[model samples]
Structure formats: C-alpha cells, structure tokens
Target chain A: MAPSTTTTYTTKQWILASKPTGAPVLSGPDATFKLQTVTLPPLKDGQLLCKVRHFSNDTGLRNFIQSTVAPERFYVPTVPVGSPMRSGIIAEVLESASPSYKAGDLVMDFHLGTWSELVVLEAATSQKLAPLPKNLSLTHYLGAFGASGLAAYTGLKFAGGAKPGDTVVISAAAGATGSMAIQIAIHLLGAKRVVGIAGSDEKCAWVQDQLGAHACVNYKSPTFVEDLKAATPEEVDVYFDNVGGHVLDAMLTRVKKHGTIAVCGAVSGYNSDEPMALRNWFELISMRINIKGFIMLDYMDKAPGILQELIGAVADGRIKLQDAETMVEARIEEQPEVWMRLFSGKNQGKLITNLIV
Target chain B: MAPSTTTTYTTKQWILASKPTGAPVLSGPDATFKLQTVTLPPLKDGQLLCKVRHFSNDTGLRNFIQSTVAPERFYVPTVPVGSPMRSGIIAEVLESASPSYKAGDLVMDFHLGTWSELVVLEAATSQKLAPLPKNLSLTHYLGAFGASGLAAYTGLKFAGGAKPGDTVVISAAAGATGSMAIQIAIHLLGAKRVVGIAGSDEKCAWVQDQLGAHACVNYKSPTFVEDLKAATPEEVDVYFDNVGGHVLDAMLTRVKKHGTIAVCGAVSGYNSDEPMALRNWFELISMRINIKGFIMLDYMDKAPGILQELIGAVADGRIKLQDAETMVEARIEEQPEVWMRLFSGKNQGKLITNLIV
Candidate 1:
C-alpha cells in the first residue's frame, strides 16, 4: 500500500525578501522577491498538497507589500519576508490526507500564499471547485467566476445601484474586476451606457470590443479630459472607481445629482507616499453624491450566491467567456516579471502564470 | 365709516448698488448697501400693507447676495440694485384689501424684503399667525418657532439620523441654526453627548450653559485641535457641519465607520474666492462616512408639521426660549452694521433688528 518511491516532488516559491519603498523592480539584485526551492513534507492529517496551476496577478499586491509598515498598512496584512507572496490560485490536489479532497480534484484558494508550484493547506482553507464546465477554463475560477466577479456584482448592485438605462463609468476597465464590472453592467444590469477608462489604446480597444463596453477612453491620451467628456455626454449616474486620484476628481464634476460612486481601489496612489488632494470635493455637497468605500472581504457571505449566478451565466453564454480577450501566459518562474504587468497595465485581460513550465 | 387720519408711514430700504468683490463693508462709501426712503404705495385688490417688526439676520443671506453671479447663485434670486435687501420678517397688518387678512394680524413672511419699515403684500403671500398665545413673543416666530428650528428638526431626524446615545458635534454651534440644533440634539433626539464649536469663549460658555450642550470648544483657542480631541474621546457618530473647511477636515479624521455628516453650510468659504481643499477626503472612503448637503428650501413640504412640533416644544417648558443668552439688538438704521456682525461672528444667538427705531 506504500506510494511509489521512484518519483520525488520539490516546490519552488517566490519569497518576499525585502519591503519595497516604491514600486518593486522584480528583476534587480535589490528585488523584493527571492526564489527558493525546497523539499515537500509528508501530508499531515486534515491537510492536502496542491500543485498551483495558475497564479492570479493582482494590483492589490501593491497594498500587500506595503503592509509591513503599520501606519501605511492597508485592509490586510502583507506576506512575511520568508513566506510565499500571496495571491488567488487555481490548483489541483496532488496528494491528500483529508477526506474532503482527493488526488486530481480542483480547487480555488483566495489569498493562501499561492505563488508556488505546490502548496500544502489545511483542508478547511479552499473551496472545492466543481468540474470546469464547457467553455470555461480553469483560470476562470481566479477571475470572471471568482472574487473579482463577485465584487463587481455586489459593488454594482449595492454600492453603485446600477439599474437599467443607467450610465456607468468604470475605471481600470480592462483589468480583472473592471472587465467583469463592464460586462455585468451591460449584459446583466442593462446599463444604457458604459464608459471605461484604461491606460493603453490596445487595452481600451479590448475593453470596448471584447467586453461590450460602449466606450473606452485611454487615460494616457494627451486629450484624456476631452475624451472622457466626449465619452460621457450626460452626467454619469454611477462611477466604479479603481484607479483613483485625478480620475476621481474628473468624475466628481460629471456625476449627476444623487449619483453614487463605489470606491473599489486606489491603485494610482499605492506607490506614492503622499495622498492626492481631491479639489472638487465640495461637489459632493452640491450634487449630493454618495461615495462608498468597498472591500470584498466584508461581503464574503454573498459570494456563494454570486458565484452560482456567474457560473450559470458563463455556461449559458449570457456572459461571454471570451470577454476576457487576452490571457497572458507565463511560467511559474516568470511570476516576478508577470506581476509587474499588472501595475504597468501591460496585461490586457487576466494574467495567469503556468506552474508546469 | 371713514378712518381717522393717522401718522404717515415711510419705508426705509437697503439696496445693493454693486456686486461685492469680497466681504461687503457697510460703512464705506463703496458700501454694498444704500439706504433709501420711499412713499408707501396704495394697497391693490387682494393686497395688504404690513409694518415690518423684526428682521431675521441669517448667514444664508450671504448666498442671496451672491445670486447676481449666475453660476454661483443660491436657491433664490438676489436683491437687485433698486430693491430692498431680502430676509424673513415678522410683521403686523396695518391695512387690508383682502378678506383673508385684517388690521392687527401678526404674520411670518419669508423673503419679504424686511430691510424696510412698511411693505405691501398679496394676502396669499404670508402665513397669518394664530392670535398671540401665552409664553410666545413676536421674536420667537423669527427664532425658535421659525425656519432655523424646522431645519434642526428635519436635519436631525433625517439627514443626521441622530438618535439616543449618539455623540453629535455641531459646528457654528452658538449661531441661529446651531443653537437650535444643540437643543434639538439633546432634548429631542436624546443624544448622549453633544459638543459645540464656537468662535469665542463667551459664545462657547453660553452654548454649553444655556443650550444644554455637554461640551463647547472655542475654535479660536491656540489649542483648538487638542481641545476638540479631548471633547470627542470616541469616534463621532453624527457631525452637523455648518462651518466647512479646516473644521470639516478635522472631523473627517475622527468620524467612526458609517458616520453621517449633515453639511448645512460652509460659512468659512462664503467670503473667499478659493474653495479650501479637503485633505482627508480619502477618509470618506476608509471610514465609509456619508456627507449630505442640505438646503431647507428643498424640505419646504415638511415645514408645517415640523413647525407645529417646534412651537409646542417652545410653549412647554421642554425647550427654554431664554436659552439664547445673547440676542444682539440693533436699530433698523444700523441694519448694515448688524448684517456685518453676522460675517464677523460678533453677534451671539440670533441677530435681531428692531424696526421701530
């Protein structure tokens, strides 16, 4: 009954070696990440070993790295210097000592320190993903059908109050959450108009063409203000902000009376020490705008229901699975370079790293 | 029956000859106000002539004067160069040409250009007060039983959502609206702790001692920040902000999660061309505070019911009418100086002008 002794397994992980003062340069000697290889331990009772098939690169990692500084700490704690950098992961159970998981069973883990070829976790840690139905990839669980999708659903439903015929403006529209938000607003919420703000022309094009957003404004354009104005002819009814700072200020002037703004992320200021000054904040009084800060961790209870709805939508073709136009693939060893794409806006859709390479 | 001839009535008015570049100086040759004498016009059908008794000096008049600047205009129109300055007035009917009114009827007239001694109005233009009930003075209609009282009632009930055990902070807490707000928060809403922010120690003392607020912080003191911090040991629940700017910034940092800020006015910026920057606006996101701008004009429909409750509270011993410790008195001729006292924070309690002098 002993397992085959011929093959041995080793795990490779990217550990946080130092705290970053600014944006982390992944390839330098002073890089924040350090790669390490180690032998796998025998599975303990109530534990399972998973081969992390895909790593979900996220902009929130910027906040994670800064958590070492208490005053500047964000909503959550950072990955320790000697531990694996944390992220959402799509994995398959390779070995199991728990009754809940068996070999070859797939799962989705959220913030379980996932930047590794193989990770051992307590059986209670991750949700067991059902078999990947037709037209859905294993990577979809880390994106369109996962936490980001649930956030888009909850934020738009409760915070944005997105309704039929509403004009919704979403920042970071080509990123993971934004892509899902745009599709949900258009296909599910029946939004009359959806305008997106993205950094590059290609990303903007993908956001408009693939995600079915009505318009996409390149935030890097020289005529960004004018483009934004043209994109939103009428006052905006709901604003889903991801990249805050000047974009938020510009939208403050554009939100209609009694409009709502869902503050999802502020990636623009994550790298800077100084918080940007919002000059037109008085408009919050004049226009009666309601701005609410949102975090997905607070709404975990709604995830099961939201994920169910998303899975059905994806399967029935109501939500186009191809909406994610680009899935940039990289080897597990290339995670440092791949993650930089998230902050640099180089990834078109979701960025997934393959563990097999 | 022919009425015996009596003393002729002459109307005194203050007209705005030019727009102010900054705060209007009343005594200078380039004064914003110009006093004029005019003969009383004959009352037309459905018209009544009233002698104005008391003029209500409100900071909102600052916005009224600003109406000439098209885009920045307040809820109503401006007092044109040839017209008398506008204000809420208490008046007695001297002559009636309509069945609805008769001689000696007391009434409250809103925006009736009270900077004059005698005025003619259509019978339908004013709310005729019931016969002078005991424990009520003519001045009460312009103060505790007037617009400010109604504002405090509705603002606390809805905008601020003040309730029992709620710790409330009222900025400009010794002024007309603020004084009423303090009493309403303490007596009506049963707020556990009420803090007042006033300009001087005398005003602060009166606000605390007479208005029944738990604590008062003089914003003019050298240790204002420490004083405010000591006054509010816990995160504030409801902040009734009347003076917005630095005070608003300070409160933004101290507000608890889901706190509500009723932004009734921004007195600090009324005289300045530049709007002050809210540096801690990000707190709106982190704390999830809701800041609502309230204009009483929008809530006119709620006035009748609210005024009835306020009048009853004043008639009973529940609300002390003598709570206004400093009712700064001024002669009708010193209207310009009295109005200037409002902007300079020289007046305590409500600023009332006696028309007979």
Candidate 2:
C-alpha cells in the first residue's frame, strides 16, 4: 500500500445530536449518527494527522456527555455539542508538522475525536506507542494497562489501605476496574479474604476462578445478603464500590469499624430514572466508616508506573486477563447492540470494539 | 458527716419497669419510679460504694433504654426490668474496700443503676475527681467538664481534624454537646468561623452571644438553608453533627471536598417512632467527605487530660462557660423535666441540674 496521502481522504465519523434525558439511545432523535464526508483541515505547526487504529469506550463517557450539557452540576463544563467526542485512540501518523513527531510513528492520542476513521490531533497530547509486551494484547492498553488500570491500582493502593489479613469486598467484581482491584487485593496486598459481588453467577464464578477471589456472591441471587455476611464472618475491611445502589447498602451494613470504601463508580444506578434510597446511613456514624470518591484523571502521574507493573505481572503469569469479546465484526449497526449487551449482563470481561480485521 | 459508714444501709431507689416506646413519660407504666428498699450490697475486694451525687442525662440514655427493652437491636443483652437505669455519674465514695480510693474522695463512675441513692462500682472504673478550680462550678462536671467536654474536644480534634481559620458548623448548637463543641472549636481549636444550627431563633442567638459562635442558623426557619449557605460561603470544613435528620441532610449538601463530619448523635430523630430517611447521601461519594461516628467511651482514656485542659481554659478565661441552669438543687423528680426542657428548647447556655445547693 503506497503511503496514505493526507491531502485527500474521507473518514467515517459519529457525532452527538442532542442531550440525552435518561439512558442513551442509538440512532434516535436524541442521538443522530452522521456518516460525514469531511476534509482534514491543514495541520498546524505542532499538530499531526493520523490514521485511527483502535479507540476506547468507557462508562464515564456518559457522565462526560451529561456534564457537557449541564455545566452547573460540575466543577468544570462538559464537552460541547458538535465537538469531537473525547476518546483515547491508538493511531499511525500519516503527516506531521511538529519536530517532536514524524510521519509513520505509532502513538496514543487522548484528543482522538468522533470515533472517526481519520483525524488530526495536537502533537503535545500524543505519546509514542510502545510495542505491546509478549502475552499482553494491544487491547490491554484500552482496558487494564490504560486509564482503567491506573484507576484500579491507585484506588486500591491509596483508598483500600488493605493490610495483610484484612477482608476486602468489591462490587462489580468482574468489570475492568473491579477485576483488577480484586486481584491486587488478594495476590499483591495479601488480603486474608476477598469477596466479590457481581451481577450474575457466571461473572461471580469468573472472579473466583480467574482472580483468586476467596468467595463470590452474585448480587442478583435471592440470598445475596446472607451469602455476603457468611463470606465475611468478621466484617469487610475494604469495600471497593464499583456498582452502587443496593449492593452499596449491603456493603455499608457489613463493613467493619474504621473500614474504608473507595467509591469508584455507580454503574448500577446510572440507567435508573430514580436512584435508590439509602436508609442505613446511621450505620456509617456508628461504625466510623470512611468513604472516598475519586476519578482516574486526578492520578494521571502514576499511569506509566502502574502500566509497567501490570505488564510485568501479566508477563509473569501472576495476573490473568479475562478478555470479553462483545464486538461484532460484520457491521457498524452491531455497535449499538454491543453497547447494550453490558446492561443485559451478557458481556463478560472487558468489552471492546474491533474496528479493523 | 459521722464518718460515712462502710456498714450496709437500706435506701429507696428507682428501677426500670419497662422501656419507653417514644417520649419517656415521667409517671407511666413504661417507666414507673419504684422505691425499692434494699440494703447496699457489700463492695468487692477492688470495689467502692459510691454515693451518687449527679447522674448525667445524655442522648445515649435513650438508646440505652430502647436497647434494654429490645435486646435484638443492642450489641449486648438488654437491662432487665426492675434493674436500676444505667448511667454515668459524679459520686463521692462513702466506703472503700479498695486501696485505690478512700472515703470522701470524689470520683466519676460508669457503673449503671445511677437513678438510685447509692452504687457499687469497680475501683478501676472510678476516676478520682480533680479538685474544682476556683470559679469553676461543681455542676460543670456533669455537663461541660464531664463527658460532653471530652466528646467535643476529641471529636473536633481527631474526627473533625479541625484547623485554625477553618469554618466549623455544629448542629444542636445550644444543647449540652453542641454548646461544648462550639466552645472547643472556637476557643480551644481557634477556628476562624463557627456556625451554629439550633431549633429556635432564641437558642441560635444565645449560641452566638453566649457561646461566641460567629454565626448561628435556626433550622426551624424557612430561610435556614439560604442563611446557612450565606453564613458559610467558604463551605463547612468540619461538621460536628449532633442532630442527624434534615439538619444533617442539609449540612451534607454543603460540606467541602475532603471535609470531616463527626457524627456524635442524631438528636433530631432520636425520639421518633420511626427513623428518618436521609436524602442527600450521594453527595458523600462525589465530595470525598469523611464522616465518622464516635462514642465518648471509645476515647475515655483521654478524658482526664481533656477535662483538666477544659477546666484550665474556664479558670483562665480563655473559654467562657454558659450556665443553662434549670434548678439550683437537683431532686429525683426534676430529672425527667430537666431532660424534657432540652427537647423543648427551654434552657439557654449549658443546661445543668445542680445536685448541691
């Protein structure tokens, strides 16, 4: 293939249409899918035009969209409508106007916009992509070894405060962040007992079998509360809250005195029109519990070190990666269906979109 | 004094007939004042016979009563019917079988059955009461310089992590614990802005003028939320929460990031037949706030030192004490009405029932 010319090229793209009232819908009045034919604007002095290789889809993207539409609710305004959807993408530079980057260099760019086929991004925002380590897939960069990886690592390291012989309970234990947190707590932190709360029995089994979790309780089970209490006879020391709502309430009741809760996400209530009510907050005062909420953006400086350590663990076979394939290779319409699969509890492990074959 | 006899003596005492369902009725079937004529049991080898002088009336007493009637909710077995009411009291030793104490020595005792004429207590549990400094009233031992004083100092110092120039918002600002917490935060801790929340405007005014709070907000006012927000524009850094119903919910919405809330008591919902529901708990996760519940018993070791410091502060005029005197002399019948006065907002400053005229 002769070198792709930046002078004339068309790329498929997706853009936001209107503000979503509740759960986002695909190809609806609220969300317009535009297959736009656009020319690449001339690169500035410190910019590069790149061919998109792979991109990430994250749960936080919805919050980001809402934040953009409603600025008053957040400390900062969210992404504006008609602007390129914020994403992290692996790409190959086809043309460069900066001394720091050259044509043909592979890199990761945070400003990769619009789920597009081709794009131009600022040179300062791109970091040269290192080759994927042996046994570690390129997709790991989008999941465990990327922002998600640092999020789990730092959250557990700082907030969990997990000491040896401590009991750790994690909700949403099969998802990207939850899976990593469980493993770190058990194998790395030397936690005595590791209990996981997942959406389904299969996810629970996966966490137990693949993550070395001492016990797994399916939140959907009728005996979830009993099972949780039985699993942690001495009360949970660290609660990694990934799925809030009823699961959070259950954890709050069972947490020990002086326990720490890392509030990473609330996937369980994200799609609900009315959030669940918390009736047992008085327990918080009686138990002297500590709850801390944070996003990965606050700890960006630790990304490189966390990624290196994660890569080593994967290479040594000490940490196992559970890859959940939800992507449909046949058509683009399947993208919306793949995203919906997460809500139905059909998807396992880290779900990603495979754009190229 | 006839050299207070070590010989057993018979005296009349009140016992718990039944647990109160809601607001404790002074003369009712649930809590009958039984004048049991019984001989004072001989003290054990390391015990002392404490002539109960002043019994403390605390919010915890309500929980103790409820727990006594309903053992299932309590951590331990309930206090049996006809047993003396459990309480903390300042007493004088009439007779001692232990070498640690002698007759006439004043002490603070935690052995229950304080709604009586006498008590048999462990010598180790009895802390020798320090001599009252000049200008410090003996009744302060049952209120300001007693459990309430230590609770406020410890909660603000450790749980609240209060720093100078920080804004501290205290609930139940005119009651025993609330008043002590305000004085500690303002005088002892050197906080810049102190905001007090009370049930009525008169109590709020008293808190500002008598207790030295920078601003006071009446929770009963229609403009309560607005006034609180305006008074604490910098946002509350340390919240000493005593009233935990709607007042806590409102305070939760205004806490700054990384703020600490010391959940000392929930007086607002203490007497309710049903516990109140908190609406704004989600703010805890987003704000990364830390809320801790504590009992004075947990920090009992620090009591003597804390009491000495408080007494010194009062003596040196570093902190001014507000005397909310309900009676010049304490009597058995006055106990119920004295406590009821607190709920009705009838007393100003620190409410105390003087046992000695």
Candidate 3:
C-alpha cells in the first residue's frame, strides 16, 4: 500500500545558521537563517509522512532566534545554531503505518522542530482533527480554533472571569490571539461592550467590523488617549494585555475599580531591547486592579474540554469564523521573508506560508 | 441618666485653615491647622459624653488636611477648611444616655470629627472593649489589637494566601501595620522565613531583635539592594507592600513566580506629589505576581470575626505583640508637633498622643 509520492523527498528547511544580534536575516550569505536541502527517511511502522500544508509564523519565534534565551521568561529552550527553526503547521498524512492516522487525514502540530515540506511525524505528535460539522476551513484551526483560541478562552475565563454584560477591552485586537479574544468576550462570554486597541486604522477597522467588536481605537492616531477615553465611557471591566507598553498604562487609567487585567503576551515589546516602562501603576492602588499572567501551556490538562467548547461554539455559529490571515502561496525558500514581515506590521492577523505552492 | 459629667464642657479642636501645597505646616499662625475652643452641648438621649484618652496619628490623616481631595482615594470625605480634622481614639465614657454605654467603660472609635479633650459620641459609633481575659493594656486596642492588626490579618489571608513554610517579605516593618504584618506572617501563618525592610538602623534592630523578624534590612544603607538579596535567599513567596516606590520596584524583580504582593499602603509616596514611577513591572508577567490593594474599610463586615482571632493569638502569645509605639504625653495644643513627627520618622511603630497629660 505505497502512496503516490516518491521514495525520496527533497525538503528545503530554514535553520538558525547564526544567532541574531538584532533582527535575523532570513536569506543570503550573512543571514541568521540559512536554507538547507535534505532527504527524508523512509516512513517506518507507527509513523506517518505528513506534508506541511501551511506554516504558522508567530511572535514566540522571535525569542528563540537569539544566541541564548535562558533568562528571558520564554519557558522554552533557545534554538541552537545550525538547528531547524521550530514551527506549527496544518499537515496532511499522505502515508500512514499506524491505526491512529490514515491517508487523507488532516492534522496540526504546534511544536515541530523542522520547517521542511515533508515531515515524518510520530503517531503521538499531532492532533487528528475531528470531522468539521460546519463548512470551516482547516486554516481556522491555526487562527481561531487552535492554540490562540484556547488561550483566549481559558485565559479570559480564569484571569478576568468577565461576567455577562461586563465591559472587556483587548489590545492587538486584529492579531491572532486578540481577534479570538474579542470574539469570545462578545459572543461566547456575552460581553455588553468590547473595545479594542490596535496600531493602525485598518487594523482597528478590521477589529470593529469583521470581528464585530463594539469599538476599536488606533493607537497610532494623534489623539489616541482622548479617543480611548471617549470610546470606553463605561470604563473597562476586563482588559486583555496582548501587547505590553504604554498602551497598558492608558488602560490602567480607564479600568474600573476592582477590574481584572489578563497578561496574555507582550508582542509589542518582543522585538525591542528597551521596552518603555509603564508610568500609571498607581492606578492599581486606587482602582484595585487584579492582573494574572498565563499561557496556553498552563491549561494543557483541560485542552480537550476547551477544544470541544470551541468547536461547539463555531458550529452553533456563536463564534463566526473570520478570515483574519495573510497566507502567502510561496515556496519553502520564502519563509524567512514572510516571517520577517511580522515585525514591520506588513502582514495581517496570522501569517502563514502555503507550502503547496 | 447622666452620671458624673457637667451639662457643658470646654474642648479644644484642630481645624484646617488652608490647603498644603507640599508639606503641611502644623503649628504657629502660618499653620494650615488652627486651634479652636468650643463648649460642648449636653449629651442627647442615645449619646455618651466621653473624655478622650488617646489620639491616633496616622498616614491617612495627610490625605485629609488638604483643601480638596476629590481623587486621592482616602475613601472618606476630605476635611473642609474650618472643619475639625478627623481622628481615631481610645476614650473613657464619663456619662451614659443609653443601655450600651456605662460610666467607666472603655471604647475605641476609628472615625471621629473632633480631636477635643472632651466630647460626645453616638452610642452606635464606637466599639465598647470586651473585658480583657488577659493582662493586655487598653493601649493594645490602638496598636496590636486595632485597625492595623485587622488589616494585616485579613489582607494576607485573602490576598497572598500563603501556606506553611512560605517566605514573606514586608516593607515599613517598624511602622503600625507593618509591625503587625511581620508577626502574623511568622506566627499565625507559619511562614518559614520572614524578612523586614525599614528605613533606619534603629528600626531595623527593632524589627530583628524586638519584633523577632528572621532578618531586617535597612533601606537607608548604601548596600540596601545587596543586603535585601542576601536576606531573601529563598526568594519571596509573599510580599506585604506597606511602602510603595523604589522598594516595590526592587521586590518586583526578586519575587518568585506566582508570588503575591498585598498592597496594604503606599507610605513612601503619600506625601510626594511626584511619586517615583515603577520600572520593573515587567517582572509581574515573568513572575506571575498577584497584587491586591486593600484598606480596613473593605472588610468592616468581617471585622468582628477578624478581631476575635487577633485577640486570641495575642492572648495565647502566638503573636508576641511587641512594644512598638512612640507615645507622647503632651498638652492638647502640642498635638500638631507630635503628629508632624511621623513624617520625619521620629516616632516608632504607632504614634499616639496621650491626652490625659
């Protein structure tokens, strides 16, 4: 029962050739990441050969390309020099040697060491997605129904614990986690008012219109402070800090007494060596704000229960799956370029490379 | 049934005359506070005429003397110019008009409009001290058994929720609430290590030797930062933030992951119009520090229950309530001078002016 694919696959992968001093160069001779071509091993018993369909490029990758990441609070090990960069992908099991996976079965792996087009996955590695009862694309799993969605659901549920009709505010509202957070706060959690803060007018418009957030304010606008105040008249009951900076300072002043703040990520400060200090922390005293920091790793024990709820919500149409991604139909050689665009804000929502092209 | 008091009594009270732009002037003609003499009317049916025995001078009083205090978060109304400054005291009931009051009964009132030597109080306003089962002094009601003690107990229980063998660090360790906090963390909570941070060498000695803290670091020392690190080798499990500012910034860097910081007060920043901004809040994310701001007012409903535990612990000698007060036996007019001593750290523990002198 051999598959249609050839016995050998020439896989092009990106590896950390040199530690990045500042921003990593993805290609060329002086690039931090250098391309390599390798032959895949023959599929063994209990292993499936998965062809990576879409590559998920994320902010966490920024922490790994450094020379060392011991004390950076990353919780994960640094990518060593000359090692393949870790990636997440929606892959198809073209050939299988185990009962758990079969041909034509689609799966997703959040932690994969190799960015190659062809990957021999262990049977225990990735999740075999259930039949999509709704007309949802597999790409939705990487953005709205995947790690980001579960993170949003679990973080908000425990950190903020926003009640029905509560006012919820989210930062980076057009990005992967923020987009999912806003939708969950509004539709699933029954929030009365959901305000979003994003960097550009287009991102704010996408957060407000496409994601159905009640209001969105562009942080780049000249009157961002006044605009934020005007938008959130009821004051914030729950604030999801997706990007840590002075924007958090602004929200510190606007959150109500006894409000909650969920520290989900600090994407805004991830690239810069010198992130700005928050100046409005005294608000924590007067307003009695509660802040909790969490990641998806904290709640992995409840992943199946959380995923079930996410799937049910999407199927029931409470969480309308939004196309909030910028997919590049590019070859594996172009991943470095696509990954670099995340820092300059050139890409939308979740950035992915469609390796099939 | 009036027992032993006269129909009218002469009393001296302090009233605010002007707003303080910086430090308050407490005496002389240029003083923001002015002394006033008034004749008290005869006590009403449900009121008791009392002779004030002790006046409690506190950091919170600084918030009241200003001309306006709309937003500083004292939780009480601002003292209007020409109105008597608010106070707390231990008083003796000289005469009674209701069943709850009897002559020679001792009572404590946390909130009073006058600082007079003699005045009338509503029977419902103050707590009549329960008969002492141990040889605890009536002064203990103003120090270890009073508002400060209740604050440390409730705040640590609910905010930090420290378990046995946890390490606790406290700032302002020689002051009212701080003194009580260090004892509770070690004795009642069974914390493994308790470290105290104070402003002076004398205070540090008092905290270490007299208060029985495991270690005490003087913030005034040139090697304060290193000294704190040496003192907290186990890393901080719970931090009781009684004084906020640079000290808090230091703790933010030293706290263990998932630690708790109870914001009891911000003594260092109370008088300053420009309190220093915190620069180390990013540690909150990496450490997952939980901070909660609370005053005694928040738990007044549970006051009776909390006070009982404090009393039992002090009586059983579990919390060796130390002598930690600067008591002044002075004339009523000299009250301003004694109150001013708090700002200069001239007093120890609770500052009290004994009115009987």
Compared with the true structure, what per-residue lDDT tens digits does model 1 show for residues B1-357? 998554446787777766566687676777788888888767779877898887888887776665223333234565666667888887889998899999999878885645887887778878887643574666767777777777777777777889899999998988888899998898878899999999999989988898888999998899987889899988689998888878887787776777888877777777666545555655665566777766666678988887777777767766776756345456677877776778887667677776665
Output the number of the lDDT-best candidate: 3
lDDT of 2 by residue, A1-357 (tens): 898564666665655555565676777556633335567676779988888766666666665555211243333345566755556676789888999888888777655544677888888877877777774567677777876777787777776677888899988788867888888787767789989889888888888988889999999899998988898888888898887777887787888877888888777655555545554555665667777766666677877777888888877877788553233342333444455566666566566766562
Q: Candidate 1, clashing residue pairs? A: none
Error of 3 at A51 (Å): 6.0
Deviation from native of the Cα of residue B12 in model 2, angstroms: 5.6
User: How many residue pairs clash in each candidate at the backbone level?
Assistant: 0, 2, 0
* Residue-level lDDT for A239 in candidate 2: 91
Task: List the global CA lDDT of all models.
Answer: 0.77, 0.72, 0.78
Number of clashing residue pairs, candidate 1: 0
Ranking by TM-score: 2, 3, 1
Better candidate by DockQ, 2 or 3: 2
User: DockQ of all candidates, in order?
Assistant: 0.22, 0.27, 0.23
Pick by DockQ: which candidate is best? Answer: 2
Return whichever of 1 and 2 wins on TM-score: 2
lDDT of 1 at B85: 81
